[model samples]
Target: MDSERDELLHTFVAEAHEILDEIERALLQLETGRDVYDVLQRVFRATHTLKGSAGSVGLGGLSDLGHAAEDVIEALCRGDLPLTTPVVSLLLETVDAARRLVAEVERGQVERSTSHQEVIARLQEARRGGPAEPQGAWATSARRATEDDAEGATSIKSIRVAVEKLDRMADLIGELTLGRNRIVRTLRAVRGEAGAALRDEMEEQDRLCRELEEAVRAARMVPVGPWFRHYERTVRDLAHAHGRLARLVVVHGDVEVDTAVVERFRDALTHLLRNAICHGIEAPEARRAAGKDPCGTITLHAAHERGGIALRISDDGAGMRRERIAARVRALGRHPAPDALPDHELFGLVFEPGFSTATESSHLAGRGMGMDVVRRRVESIQGTIRIESREGHGTSLLIQLPLTLATIEGLSVGIGDERYVIPLRAVLACCDLPRGSLAHGGAQGLMVRRGRALPCVRLRALFGLGGSPPPDERVVIVALDGFEAGLVVDSLDGEGRTVVKPLGQLFRRVPGISGSTILGDGSVAMILDVDALLGGVVRDAVPADALDERRSAPSAAGGSPG
Candidate 1:
């Protein structure tokens, strides 16, 4: 009976942490015009559950703290006290204390420590009209108490799963697919009229097996909302620390993404939201002086766009200061002409390593590691980030990423005998090009389409195919960072979603290749890094007129390539 009770307590602790995360997110949203009743009700419910479960398990210390926290939430729900900054801060502190108490209970050691008493006092104080006690002292004591209480009792339910599990599952699925392929091949080779019925049965088995595999994959997906909630608290705390009345608004909170992608994107989203609060939103007084609302708004919205997930973080505060960025770039000996640089390029400078707009270091984000880390992490997942800023209006960051990390739709292209896959989402259009129009030089030329000049790169030359360009070669126009460019290839295969597998360590530094995917025919296709490829074209100083002429010329092979 004791063992069963302990197991139940462990489950409570794990579930309580999940609930606490949701409550913290709600409180953050409450700071930004959310209904007080709704937020308080959620906070109360989480605390109530903790209190009930802890008491049932004879955890007096946890039960006491949980009840106190619940009391404060109930009062806030009743409108007994306004949800002021100090109150919200104290509530956040109380949530932390409760979390520690739950951890102590999970360890089977309940400490009647001073930190727990302080949390009770603060909760009661908020019930009255007193300001919260210093949070720093409470934080230190809570950590120490949790450390002291570490024991044989651990919540194993919270154990981290290895990424290799997902990898192994994917590999197993691949093998199963190969098995199905072999069965089909055998069915086709069977030599009798009686084998026809057997082949039909094999086809039915294949369909059910494929459906089962897809269902299992779908079960692994977790909603991204829980991960998205953490950013709300981060934004709230950063805004308060900086004396800015910044409100974070989130959209598509219910969107489901793969668990691996969610885990990978969590830090990137944190850095982006922190940057929006610390660098984008100005102080209330400054906002008033600038003739804008004193309470700044930072909106974080996510949705599906063009077969990918688009997340945009926008702030209605002071926008990017190009002159300051240009000055920094000049100091680094990169460029000195701020006025000559485009707005998008100037805003992109923030992502450069060791670059920051902050005049001095702060606890928030002045160390210059924020945007650079964001860029690297996003790139690690084969995603792209873009920035748009107006001088005085505001700044917005647009991040476009595939829906899944495991598989992506790709357009297969042949460069010599080597095959490469361009993410179909990245390919704007494909057309055949005349051999006479493509200029041959170190720098690829541009093509003009719809009155816009688009750069053109011969895929054969770029990949060093070491053969003459095909007379009926195709040009795949890809759009990246607001620029369109074309890659000349020998042929275009059909588009399909292929599971992308990472290349070996030797190919890690290979230019213009993000990863590789295996096709239905069991052939390996290299996935092109459209950003890197187009960036290469721009860096080579390709002439604009040549790009214009290539785009205007009719394809010698008649219609669109794919």
Candidate 2:
């Protein structure tokens, strides 16, 4: 009986949090002054349901808070109260309070507290059309929803599985993938020794294994709609607090991706949005002075691209200034000439620790911390972030991430004794790079490909594998976020349907390597970060001779394969 009751409590907590998320989003919509009536109705209904569920579970304190919040919305619906900023803000605060109560329920603790009483009192005041009284609960209720709840409701189409269980399932799928690769590789070598029947059975098993892996991956997929909606209130409140009129516009919210990928990107997305609002968007007066609309627009767009997902956060605000960043860079005493650096390098400084141009700190930004964290988080998921700005026009951040972290179709290539997997989406083609075709030295190298100068990175040299290059080295051309590069490899193995497992923390900071996958022979192969490597090659300077060689090769079929 106790076990059943505990299960019921868990369900209630999960449902309550979902309702609270809706309430918060509704409050944000109300702030926008669009669909006010519908939003208010939705908020009221969610709170009413939350009240009933909490009461049913004997979580009286949580129920009371919900009841108070619902009353305020009901008052608004009945024309007893106005939808003033204070009213909406108070309701938003109540949502925060309810979130805390639900968290307490999740932790199996008593929900009632002094802070809950204070929130109830303020909510009552707000409902009565009086100014919501400043209460002691304000400090305690000031909780930011930093992370997402892992639990989601079960439906007829789906069963509720614990997140840990899903994680374990993914791990098992990865191991299965590794084992299957081993079997296939071994079978291929001994095809003549094995009978036709045995070969056919192994082939059938491999097919089933692939199908099962895909099914598991699909099961872990989640739509970005709910996740995207959760940030509406955050942008609204933070924009208002900073006295900036800004709106968050989310597009293509139905894009599906791995739940783990979404969770991994949570903090990074939040930080980037916050940075856009705090630094990219300017005050109303400043915007007007720049001959732009007083109100700013921040867009969160997600879509499927190249078998992966692309998320873009853009703002029509005073775009970032390269000069200002260079000035900040100089203030840190880093180089002989800061302004002489290229725009990409200047922008790259934003992700460096203690890199900021803000003159002062605020509730939302400053302290130069968010961007660095954003960069680190994106890389952790084997993703890439690209920033584009037009000075007075605006700024756009494009982040490309895999749809699922579990498995990817990659081009497995060899570099001497080591192997690496390059994402198939990024791979353009493979070709032989004749000796001496690679121009320039040091960190920068270039080759000519079909009349265009292409940057190249030698994997053996990059990873310090320290071996003689093969007589016939191959180069795999890869394209990421409009940038193109060629990765010089020892040999081109065939296509790989590889499962990606994250490397340990000790290797987390290693450049150009994202994760590791177990190869067919039970050896681990590193997954290359083509985006980062290309960016690094761009950052380095190519010698004049290399440029001449690249220019001269345009008539020689440009060094690309036919």
Q: Cα miss at 275, model 2 (Å)?
A: 1.3
The TM-score between candidate 1 and the true structure equals 0.83
lDDT of 2 at 158: 35
Q: Put down candidate 1 lDDT per residue, 229-324, tens digits, no spaces.
A: 545555555676666777766788777666666667766776777777778899999999999988888887888887778888899989888878
In angstroms, give how far residue 282 of model 1 lies from its true place: 1.5
Alpha-carbon TM-score of each model against the true structure: 0.83, 0.81
**Which residue pairs clash within candidate 2?**
none
Q: Please report the candidate that would top TM-score against the real structure.
A: 1
Name the lDDT value of residue 434 in candidate 2.
52
- Residue ranges of candidate 2 with Cα displaced over 4 Å: 1-11, 110-112, 133-159, 162-164, 177-194, 284-295, 322-349, 391-393, 416-418, 438-447, 451-470, 478-485, 504-512, 520-524, 531-562
lDDT of 2 at 399: 87
